[model samples]
Target chain A: MISYLLRRGSRVVRIILFISFCNAVLAEVEIYGEASYENRYFVEEGLFGQDKSHSSFTLSPEFYFESEDQKTSFTFKPKIRRDSVDNERNLFDIQDFSLVKVQDSYETRIGIRRDFWGVTETVHRVDIINQTDQVESFDGEDKLGQPMINLSLEREWGTLDLYVLIGFRERTFAGEKGRLRLPFPIDRNSAQYESSAENLRTDFAIRWSQYYQDLELALSHFSGTSREPEFKAALKNNTNLIIPYYEVIDQTGLEVLYIVGGLAFKLEAISRSGQGDRFSAATAGFEYTQVGILSSSLDLGWLFEFNHDDRYKDSPIALGARLTFNDLYDSQILSGVIRNEETGETNVFVEASRRVRNCCRLSFESVYFNEGTNSNSVQKTFEYLKQDDFARFEFIYYLGN
Target chain B: MRKLFKHFLFVSLFIFLNFTNADDFDRGLEIALATDKNFSGFGDSQTNLKMLLKNRKGFVTERKMKMKLLEVPNDGDKSLIVFDSPRDVRGVAVLSYAHKVGSDEQWLYLPALKRVKRVASKNRTGPFLGSEFSLEDLSFQEIEKYTYKYLRDEDLEGKGCYVIKRIPLDPYSGYTKQIVWIDKTDSVILQIHHYDRKSFHLKTQIFKGYKKYLNKFWRPNEIHMINHQTNKTTTLFFEEMTFNTGLSEKDFTQNSLKRSK
Candidate 1:
């Protein structure tokens, strides 16, 4: 790992030198980032041997440089985290390190970066480029930087993006001491891969997106190692441990969004092969907002989504609401509930945040899970997390720009 | 002969009143068109903005952002605003495509999530960055968005001004009408009195320290907005305003929003 970091360090040095050379010709550089502290408290004891609480601190710094002509730019962002209880929760990753050149109709970017795709608020079935940084957040909103060469073209029809992804990063998992974990820990070091090239495999993706009137649509296809992994049981240290098995797969995705007045309709669907059998999944939802509700400055938004996965027999529906207080502090709250129709399992989540003074923000989040009353029903891996209900608070302070 | 003379007087008086009203309407629209035309050839502009939001208790909060605008020939202008401070919102950007009629199009880019979300434009009455200025107040102004009537002539800050009353065309607009003061010499806006839906005096905006750019375009260095009802005020200061930086449509796309700093 040290050798690998050294190799990456050398490349960063070269990029800085190039930027310094352009500095003489009017290139500008900006430095900014954030430091955050988090405290988590669990309402229930873990099913396994785990701590009832955890504390973590994170630092993420960003450096950006742009040319005077606005045609060339470079960005570097590195993040580090230290956890008090769970060692596996500790993280060190470069979130973004990329250089881009923009032309009249085309743009090219190279190096590591993060990319997101999808419109629905509940599930992002079409966002397949970056691997999930699960240790950072189980909600799957956080992602590790993907190293790639991206080419984007702007045409009359739409915007076309092509990506050539190099190498693969394994998904992080919780340790035995982690609260939000399966019955057994995942032995990441012994992970299995279907591809002979293993983590060295290269991936390719293409997407074409466009906005027509009030409708926005995108079609994408990906051929690479699947970011989602299947699990197998293996014996480790006199105990059975879960071993993740990566698979090579091809995926085709579709995204649609239609906006009318204060309402938006969204749909994201995907079909994938090489994971057991060819299957499809979809999430369709709508968000309706009422601005200045009740003659007040607060805006209220309602969201509803239905999720279906072919591999899983159970279907789930999600309902959510977002409230924005257009006050001086920019306070907002989002709460949601997802329930399975067949098993009656439910998950509830809430997040509220507001800006503190000038450079700081404070947020509170809580998540709860309830299992079906039927004990004879099929036990899913997520059943282990039923007792992991927790609430967390985070305070973030941003650095100067 | 007396009855016939009285009927003739009535007919002449009606015609004269109709003609004067038509003239007033035409004159108000002509002035609005002239002001829009005067600023048409700027092509593009870029500026840094700093806002000081002061509450009724004299407490203050500051916000900083950068603005870029590209002129569209027949349609409304396109603009991009990127926040720089209140450091928590740094790198957040909003891209907008203003239209002459109907609702405008807006998209918000969240830097941390790398997500570009389409925003509903109907919420134009919401405060911008928690400041006294609403989203509509900062949006591009199009002559078609309002109906105008010539109120009178007035003197503002020692400058000859044309006072006009204009009502918003959007049903969701928070204001019922606005009284505007435009400089007669340069067609620059000097001040405005905004009235709420109840026709109550709501706010007053004063533009100060105007500077001419490219020997043609008039730009304001500072804009002071005072909320009469809430006793809150927001002052916007513009720095290093530049024009004709050669920005094209490509610079305002969703792809560019993610790249903005």
Candidate 2:
């Protein structure tokens, strides 16, 4: 085991050396990223066997290099993180490291990267290129980088991108002591795959996006091993376990947005063919903003979004679908306010300073996982998550030049 | 010879009559529009700036950001600002597309969420990130967004200038009116006094250290804004600037905002 760890460690060092050498060779370098520490303290005590609080420290550094003419560039962002509660959650990752070359009307990028596609705020039904880094956040705000070679062509009509993705990365799950988690701890050793080639399968995707006046639209198609895994109950370490089962699937998605006045309407729909019958899902929402609210300099935005998954309307796999489409609530209405205080413009923010989420929210969120206390259903994951609904106060300080 | 003298006298008299007239409102708009037109037609620009914020208590902090502006013909200009320093704001970018006919569209991209949230462009009176500058102050400063009133012609710092009071057409402005001093020699803003919504003097901004870039573009090397009520001040220095950059409309898009360094 020591020799195995040594080999992996040496590989990491070699890659880091190679990347730094490349950056050194390229002169014009721009370095960026942040060092941040955040703690999330649960309001109440642990449920069953969880901790009352969780804290993490992160150092995410990125470097970018481009030529004088800007035709060729290399971008790299390496993240190192440490978590107090869950040892499995602490790790290192290459969030984005890509080499890109731009030609007339076209650009080609090769390496690990991150890509997003979708318009709705509630759920990202159309964004599936990168796997979810589940331990990072409960909102699915973090993503694992995907290894891909992408060629993009810009035409008068729109921009077209074709991607050949390799090195399939599996979605991670929360550890046992984590707050939001499945009923049983997921056993990575028991993972199963539909394809015999398994993790070696290469994925491919193509997307075309266009914006015209008040309307923006994009259509994408992806075919490969699914980033999402299905869990089946199993016996492991004398405890009930949910063994991850990976499957291959094809997904086509369309995202659209239209803006009129101070409001914007967004829709993201996806149709996939995978385990069980064919299914389709969509998240539709609209954001209405009241500018300069109440004769003050504040802006208030009201967001109303609803998600519909045809698979969830069914009986047998409804609860499973809920677990798969975790953050997507059936109906969610959130209102947020943003105010730029005239006093703390520099370093004088008092209690809650420069909050991007700004003011506050009393959101009404409802989702149905299942109506039963069945041990097979992971409905408890969502039930336990309700305890994490919190009102947080944050203080932000700007560091560095 | 007599006819030429008579013609010149009549023309001089006509100019004198309008010069001292009470119709300063019309002249105010003319001066304002002339100032706007002088800075027009430069395709685009890229600038690096360092900002210093100091409170009344003598505490000082610094910030660095990169700004890119692209001029839109027959309309308001579009700009993109990416904050590079201040690790907390690293990778935060804002894209603003100003229009001549309507409210501008501004989008703020937060790197933590990898999401671009829309900001109400009309929320212009509020300070921008605790700085003395507002959304309108950093915007394209389109002439159509305000109504002008010429106050007087005065000599400021030995240079001829026209002082004007401009009222924003948007009612939500934090100030009822802003008095501006435009230098006549170079058509640049020399000073501006911002009033609160209650029509009281709140802050004053001065532009100094002017440098001509690309021979035709005159940009201020340093700008100091002082808040009278709070005794706070923020100063911005344009560390480096380049005009006529080859930036297209694509660089100002939402995708470009996300990709900003």
**Where is the poorest 10-residue window by lDDT in model 2 chain A?**
A319-328
Clashing pairs in 1: none
- A1-401: candidate 1 lDDT, tens digit per residue: 24433644565456456545644564356777787878889997789868788877777767788888889999888888777778888888999899999987899999999999889988899999999989777578999999999999988899999999998888989888888888889988888899999988999999999987678899999999999999999997898989999999999999999988778999999999999889999999899988778767788999999999998868889999999998889999999999886776888999999999888999999999888675556545358888899999999989664
Check candidate 2 and list the clashing pairs: A345-B130
DockQ each candidate and list the results. Answer: 0.67, 0.16
How do the residues B1-261 of candidate 2 rate in per-residue lDDT, one tens digit apiece? Answer: 999999999999999997776578788988987777556878899999888888788877676899999998988899999976555566789899887776677888987666666654544555565676776777777888888888889998999999999998765566788999999988889999998877889889999998877777778999999988768888999976888779988777665676677
Q: Which candidate comes out best when scored by TM-score?
A: 1
Q: What share of the true interface contacts does candidate 2 keep?
A: 0.15
Pick by lDDT: which candidate is best?
A: 1
Best by DockQ: 1
lDDT of 2 at A18: 59
What are the per-residue Cα lDDT tens digits for candidate 1 across B45-148? 99999999999999999999999999998899999999999998999999999988777888899998899988877767877888889988999989999988
**Model 1 residue A57 lDDT score:** 75
Tens-digit lDDT string for candidate 2 (A1-401) = 24433644565466557556755775467655554555666665545568766766555657777777666778888877667677667768898899888776677889999877778764688888898898776458689888999888777788888999996787777677766666577776667888888887888999998876667789999998888888899986689888889899999999988877656788889999986788999877777666445544344556666667776532121101010110101112232321112111111101122222211112222221222334443323244454443332222322223
